[model samples]
Target: MDRTRFFVRVAAVYALIGAFMGSHMAGGGGLELSAIHAHILVVGWLSMFAFAVYYKLFNIPKNSKLSVIHVWSSFIGVFGLTVGMWLYYTRPIEGMQTFNTIFFIVGGTILLIAFVVFAIMAFVHGKFISEE
Candidate 1:
């Protein structure tokens, strides 16, 4: 239920995956998934971790409805975007490129909405703490 912790943990997982992919590529595993790997690290690891830091510093309540929504939506967005892109580029299903395009777009849109919601929450609950 700790939203900040949840986001951070998710980011950690993404970090591990990204590192693994980087290693694989360095080992000459081809550059086929380079874009997917980059997005996974940037959007999944960095972005989620940044969100965690924001929530922590902003003192957003873990039990807030907005927190729950942000957590789920962000996770879904990251997963959808990464997986969809991978599938699209890989063409594992032969005729699913259109589906993958839609999937990634929807995912990106969901992520955008989540960020907007987070911005609203931040502005509504944010207060400047003066260091004395």
Candidate 2:
């Protein structure tokens, strides 16, 4: 399948898993797990899936290597951020505080880069209509 569709599907799966885990954690009453679950559902699932749908609906060129790069980078970035949060919350480190901070910053930067690239590609595609 196309990259956009593929990513959307993957994001959906992540969302479902996040929901399940969140509910389970809530039922058992754990604050840390709940927070991690929220992060995964919101960032990893909802945001990523929304971006995928946006890219697909906008008809981003399949051959655009930049779009491909954006997709992969954003995916990895979000995945890392979510996973890192999960790790940090579940296994609180006593002195390795910098590790979690670095993970978040790196992931956020990667996602920001992906957004910039995606915007550039979309603008270059001339899909936007100007009422001059």
Candidate 3:
């Protein structure tokens, strides 16, 4: 699938998951899980997905290595962040505290890099405008 479609699909899935989790939280579900769900849905799903879709729809060069890097970094970052948070909350390991912190920080940094790369790609590639 194209990047735009891929991003949209990811965003939609995240939104749906968020909604389900919200309902569960409202019904007095676990607070830690709820917080993790919110983080994944908001940062992982909504924000990252929106940025990816915007970059693609704006016609950023598909051939750019930066694009590939952005996609892979984002996927890995989100996966790591989610898994780290799950482990941290469930197991509550003292040593893993530092490890989880590193995961979150690295993941966030990678995501930020993705956004920067996307913005640069978009600017360099230019937007698609219709002739008047």
Candidate 4:
């Protein structure tokens, strides 16, 4: 029901996953997945968590259409981008790399759109409230 809460929870989950991956590497796991792990931590965990905090701190209405759009677009976009990157680098489908590259591009574009939308929302609504 609460989009901010949902995004925060997703961010927490991503943090756990990223930490686990990092620990696994430190414990001598293969280092080949480092890029994917970094993206997971950065884009998935940090970005989403930041968005959640921004929405909550800014007092954005939960029921606002932009709220919902922000939640779903960020979720889907990050998921696609991260997974596409994982598959692209780790799986290495010979003929499919082109398709994978396109998928990654599309996901990145979507995420960029989400950021632009959020920027618009912030500039449109963000104002210093002076306590009279």
Q: Which candidate gets the maximum TM-score versus the true structure?
A: 1
Per-residue CA lDDT of candidate 4, range 35-100, in tens?
A: 989999999999999988787667676666776777778888898888888778876766788888
Candidate 2 lDDT, 1-132, residue by residue in tens: 377677788789888989899788778887657767887887778877877777666766778788788888878877777767765665576776678777777877787787788777767876642333
Ranking by lDDT: 1, 4, 2, 3
Ranking by TM-score: 1, 4, 2, 3
Candidate 3 weakest ten by summed lDDT:
123-132
Candidate 1 stretches greater than 4 Å from native = 128-132
Top lDDT: which candidate number? Answer: 1
lDDT of 2 at 73: 82
Q: Residue 86 of model 3: what lDDT? A: 69
Candidate 4 TM-score over all chains jointly:
0.86
The reply for model 2, stretches above 4 Å from the true place, is: 92-97, 128-132
lDDT tens per residue, model 3, 2-56: 6667666767776777787777877885565886788779876887677665665
Alpha-carbon RMSD to native, per candidate: 2.0, 3.2, 3.0, 2.3
| Error of model 3, residue 59, in angstroms | 2.2
Please report how far candidate 2 places residue 22 from its true position, in Å. Answer: 1.5
Model 1 vs. true fold: TM: 0.88
Question: Model 1: per-residue lDDT, tens digit, 1-132?
Answer: 777889999999999999999999889959888999999999999999998888767666656787788888899989888888887788888777889889878888888878888787776656531222
